[model samples]
Target chain A: MTIGEVRENPAPAASVVRQPTFVVEPSKGWLALNLQEVWEYRELLYFLAWRDIKVRYKQTILGAAWAIIQPFFTMVIFSLFFGRLAKIPSDGIPYPIFSYAALVPWTFFANGLTQSSNSLVASANLIKKVYFPRLVVPISSILSGAVDFVLAFIVLLVMMVYFDTLPTWNIVWLPLLLLLALVTSLGVGLWFTAMNVQFRDVRYAVPFLVQAWMFATPIAYPSSLLGEPWRTLYGINPMVGVIEGFRWALLGVNTAPGPVIIISSLVSVGLLVSGAFYFRRMEKTFADVV
Target chain B: MSDVAIRVQNLSKQYHIGGTQAGYKTLRESLVEGIQAPFRRARKLLRGQATGAAELDETIWALKDVSFEVNEGEVVGIIGRNGAGKSTLLKVLSRITEPTRGRAEVYGRVGSLLEVGTGFHQELTGRENIYLNGAILGMKKAEIERKFDEIVAFAEIEKFIDTPVKHYSSGMYVRLAFAVAAHLEPEILLVDEVLAVGDVAFQKKCLGKMGDVAKSGRTVLLVSHNMGAIDALCETTVFLEQGKVVDIGQTPVVIQQYLSSLYDIADYSLQNRVDRGGSGRAKINYIYLATSDGLPLQQVLSGQEVMIVIGYESQIPLNHPTFKLTVYNNVGQPLTQFDSSLTNALFIQLPLRGYVGCQLGKLPLSARRYRLHASLDNGVELLDHWTGAYSFTVGPGNYYGTGRNVVGLKDVCLVDQTWQLLENAPEVHWSV
Candidate 1:
């Protein structure tokens, strides 16, 4: 279908202030983001999120245990290699407590990347057969990763007790940081998932990207390794603020991640906005290319 | 719009149909085209020339200038041969894909069983998948809870509901999927080709459920290859051809128009996509059915030659073998059996054959679609046998004028004729 004359309705737009166009014309011009329509389908978002959770744990020998085990064992390995042997800095907190806190968010990000990157390809049958907002597939993948995030947070609680550390008033900011991480994951996920549908090379590229990203973030080491603007520069990774915010909230860092956290938060939101725009732009090609 | 359940005006979807090369354009090609595009556009503007967007290369309209509206509670069947844009139209209506040209507004909550078990997890138990699929099909958890028992009973998987679905047979999987889709109520239901998966009995059950749904006043859009199912369920049918609405009218008339165009070779060429199954493992060139009198008939008269010829490529000699052919009806029921092992040509062998012709003489059959099932094997050790290889149509016929050929025959494969003249019929009074 070629682009035709644009038709505008006088209906009031939703909270997302943009001229919401129901029709999409690929040949005409730039793609417009329709958050209003997406907002209407929010119930579908919840159902898809629920479907992902049920399917993930259904019939698993470990069931929900795998969720806890992933972050927990990761805490152990980081403790052995980076904590005791390598003598990596933990910002004065017990290394075990420090790494476990970072592992919680890192695991969510890693899992989100893994699931969302393959989502479109994995749901090829659904794409070819039926119609729905294709973005729902990857978005649900990210949301479901939130389930494991909450479950793994329990282990972080136990680590806090073992360290005899209680969360400070700063812990109120934890939800905001978690939102930052979520936005970041969804952002990167959208880009990779759309690419994965076309190039298929993204499947192999994802694991490598995640591994490099983990070391790049302060998951195993502290952002302290790269001092000053570089650390703030490292905040460009976005997840740095999320992990450092958890450490600061639970372990009480003297500096509240300060400029680094702000930089990281801003970068994370930026990634999310740009990723979504790219995804919306490329969405029209998916049905044909996939 | 009369509170239209679904409305579309000039809905069109454009697909690039990408080239074989990755990234589509190489760096050098992009460089050359990049340099040429600006110059061409500038030259055209300076010379007061015109540019036609339609001239875009490799551009094909999968759906073009399509428009329609469906009232709530209507059962509409989208009928067309493959690539006629029926699926694309459905996809746009369901919002699976956005329309490239026009606008479509679907009122009320829409539930699409686009494919059976669209989100079914293999590792999940049948019970778990019920919940997963229910949610995927847009059902609330409480809604699923209310219908859980009915769904289980309908799928007939109560005994193994707790077991992982991966362990269930393909039939069980489809049944559970159908059950979930059937029980969940939504304002509108969009079903694709899933009905073709389940067995005959299950298909009937699904049809019955769909009939109930229609009576309950919910919009239903069904797309199926089975004309019989469409005629029985859909009150109106829309025919699509080459991405255009060719016809939309009463079920029978629309179907007649669609099938009437099927005799031409173009009809067959448009649909066949080189199916790889049954005889795919063996090297076969062509397979066709011929009458006993050596006449190639598309519509066979009952009690005519039902011979099958198989062309194959063989590089080496073959041993003493038996060839078996079983004929099946359209519904996959075996109507006749002809095994070479039972005939005198049991030990025949061909040495380094290039092309071979085999024949079966048959003068008995009922009016129906008969498929050719063939197998070539040395006794005991099976080489290859094509199960449900080819199909031909058999028309009803009367063999005898006096002794009605419809004489009751013991064999199901036997074609017996029967006739009676109402005026000449005799009536006898009981001697009480």
Candidate 2:
């Protein structure tokens, strides 16, 4: 007999001994987190983040120096327009260092949001071709911004020395504050990236949203300009807590944004959980739509 | 360890076709739809109250309840025409897209190469891209590092390893991409038509590597239009048509089924087919198949007399018209051609509108389905051409009247011959 005939007859025997290792089906409900899958693909996340950093500065003469240039120039512009021209209050600190402190985290947050929001559409080819936790795309994009944040942070340290303003013990909260910025950026980024897959308008809307959000945050002016209840309400924008926290921790400002930070932290966490659920809901359709 | 490598049950995927608000709607379209949505819902509710049924008419089922299973260490080939959901099947199996319904269970780590150079960044160096692409294909960093030199040597681009991939030649780039993919070492490898790229030598190398991969007892699911590769590698093949499994069995059998289905002609129509190219000065309105006796023949026996009738409409009268007709065998290989100019039928006057018949006293073909492609050209300007305009089948026939059937990989023609015994001469040569 031919091999096909022999194999066909033994198919039942072959199937009886089979045990599947992975089963794929339509995702149901909101709890399709699949965190273990992401953890297993962690190396891919690292490589992707590395790729972004490598490709970003490739062929550019300044290389990683562009990271510092971007925020430094923005700080110069803000200091001239808001600090010098408008005489904005710096909460008893020098306005250049004051705004520069907030701008450090603000730049990180803004860059993270812009990159993560467009990550899905930018890597549509990878998403369509391979099978990975789609979350890795936006997450890695947000993480790659950490490189720029670090480069820009070094420049901020140099500026702090130039201004001769030493930070106090509150600098210990810097890591926690940075984590808050990371979470808040990823939270809002997930929603926009997921929507961007379907509606391409999110790509156009993101930069505008970042611009408006900058004004809404206390980067140009201290949160001390407002009173108690209104100030706490303004903390609904997550960057308010992150920027103010940066100023308080780095500049040792006397404003003490206690209630605002608490409210902003809660709001940021809430955005993350809801945004993740929405992202998971739209994840299955990414390959089909994108 | 289980014997079954993959199992798919009742898998289906639906797509909305040409709907104003389906599948990646733009922001403007979404906004417009959002504005009109309330009115649409109200109208739908009113219509439902009247007719008790409201159905949207834009959806099409790309795959419909398709079911199949593949055993471990088996190399299975999926063959189909375009839009047959072959890619869709691979996509669903690879988890690139979730199925709308049903479940596919994979027994091993599935590494899918849907396209080579999937995530290669042009700005990145070749070495960096190798690691990046390997990681994208689910290879661990340690695994990629261990096989790094082997991959580079296999790609034959060791000299350009540190250069940006944008500086590499297209051939070199494809080689590196395919090398990384081939060395992926996943228990189950899913490849989709990626071998169709690169030069002939590279393609041969890829095929050889794939053969080696199959021999090493890894389950491979491949989707390709290359019948030679499929026949050489796969023991069993699945034939899909219109998103459903039509046949799944031995490679040759399933391949023959897929080939014949291309010319099945049950629902085939030449009208309104947009796959033709040329200036449409003259058009073939209809094509007909008939026997020597002038009877329309849907099917004919091998070595029988046949005629192909072509009816045309021309905007202007033509002079010195020539017609060329080519017959392609079951595997889409062009076997023979009958050109009017080559047969000394050139320089004939042609009217603006008339039917032309090309007759053959005896059809020199084997028993198989053949596709017909026809084109008309004048001496100065070409008129029109239609590819795959019609198809017909040739059944088994006793051309020699010996009551013997010619079948199964035989020559595609019946040649008359005489056999003589050389018994007297053989006896004289016994000394040797």
Candidate 3:
């Protein structure tokens, strides 16, 4: 008949514990990125990425070698077709080593894009049952790609040794170039994955998008084939700059990343920032629709 | 050090359904609609029919204007029937989904245990999954490590801790998951009906761990249909029905409201209910409870005579038909059954269109709600095995006397028994 009033205690000082308090409410406006909450679950991100890497290699006979083998075989296929039959020029370098350099970054970007795009839907059970920054799911999937990139990079090193190609001062730009590829992958991945949760057509569109994106980049051939402002415009695809930078950094190719690097960096940062906002915007409906 | 742990404003969430927004639509359809949207708007404007009044627009407000608060170190219970917004309220509090309108603010570190071992990888080792599950439930890496040995010891999976959980037996798997969940120390805890799972020992273990959490002075909000647990732990309970709060008061008062709101009349139309099995040759139309005088009965005492009336219509004539009526406890454990095959010779055959009344001499059930399961068959092939028929409630009062009673009543069933003292003692025969 009556609502129970909370009885006030006289000795309230002993029961009051000082701790951090966070409020949850409906989000307003366009941008709702909670990077601090994501940072709080950084260890969870590490464990998730670790779990993905561990599970990917488990029960496979070839194990981590699959990472190297995946990029190696793709490079072989491109060389056999584009180099042997199509006679595509490799900027005065051997086609195998040249294609291998580009494939390393290309495969990393492609894998990161595919995986992170499906990450939210893939972890729907976790999202529905618990609360963490949903950003961790996609970000962790992207982190796992970095491990594969390291393993696949070893093959590029071996191929360079076989061709006796020496590294140039451009090699110093490798880490920054790798980061750009990651940013671009995450940026596009967030868009596709967020839409994928609602429409599911984005799931089928992803592989097609990656395939189309691969050809648009200069993977088998050199970007030097393009002249003038066209070369700069090609950087709009983002991977063009990444692949060209890879070839220039490791093989010391004359086709250096000039205005393309600037364009790629700017576009990738824009994609990363914008994609993050869009992902956060759609995050409100993920538990229901997913 | 705020006294209130959670303050929920007029939180409301609306869900779109049954139209272009009913379920997930493909991108192609959405793109086509996007492309045609402007032209369709123009045509609608020309015709003056743009408001879509002729369309069947559907939406569900899972939670509407729900407001409540729990103070520091206080335990609150939310009780409701299925689809009563109990789970939705918890989901909103845990930040799994944002409200459509209004807001809710939660203080302290919140740990929501809606499902056990969420995000656990089967390919990972038991040791690995413990850490993984702990982290997902919001425990820190160092905290999981500190309790790692205790959890493994509690789960008794130390011998196979390094083995992938896919190889563990289901029992071991749940034990490991529960161990990790029990160790999750948070400032505020939101628990669903996760305790209503596994074997008796596992439930006892969960209750023990929950009691520890309560004793440790943490804020807890539990959503469960188990009134016993709620009554024992929570001083205040909130009753929700049809997406709105019906009452929020002391445990007993709200629980009384919850019970009175269930199965008070012969309300369900069984003919239209789809959750059933077996052939449809003989279908049950409706079911209800009645007294011996054929009066509609809502509830009965522990020792009162009860009659279960089942209405059915058969498509063809049945010879030597078999019928059954079953009683189940509130938690859905089957208590007893009255099968016609045991006494089928009483009647030559069941009628094609009529009511079947299986009368009970005296109901020995305790004071609680009960559901029914009934079936009918034309002698050999099963016709209908209706699993969840109309439900009824038993009494909070006395039973009829002057009858030999059943002994060893396990508190779930009432059995009238006599207690007497013997005047003489018999000599013990101890032959060594």
Find the candidate with the highest lDDT and give its number: 2
For B1-432, candidate 3 gives per-residue lDDT tens digits of 337788776778876655654442899988887898657754643332312322337778888888777877888888887888999899989989888887766778899988777877999999999989999999999999999999999788999999999998988888888889889889999998766555667776777788788778898988877655666567789899877888888976676556546555342443235467778888876566666533346467677788776667788787777778888887988888888778644556666766667788888887777878888887678888877766776765555374533232457777667778977879778997
> Which of 1 and 3 is ahead in TM-score?
3
Chain A TM-score per candidate? 0.89, 0.93, 0.93
DockQ of 3: 0.42
lDDT of 2 by residue, B65-115 (tens): 777778789999988888999999999999888787988889998999999
Interface RMSD of each: 9.2, 6.9, 6.3
> Order of all candidates by TM-score, from best down to worst?
2, 3, 1
Chain A TM-score, prediction 1: 0.89
Q: How close to the true structure is residue A151 of candidate 3, measured as C-alpha lDDT? A: 88
Candidate 3 has a TM-score of: 0.73
Runs of candidate 1 exceeding 4 Å displacement? A1-44, A54-65, A72-77, A225-230, B1-7, B16-59, B103-108, B265-432
Q: lDDT score, residue B246, model 2?
A: 82
Off by over 4 Å in 3: A1-20, B19-56, B265-432
Candidate 1 lDDT (Cα, 0 to 1): 0.72
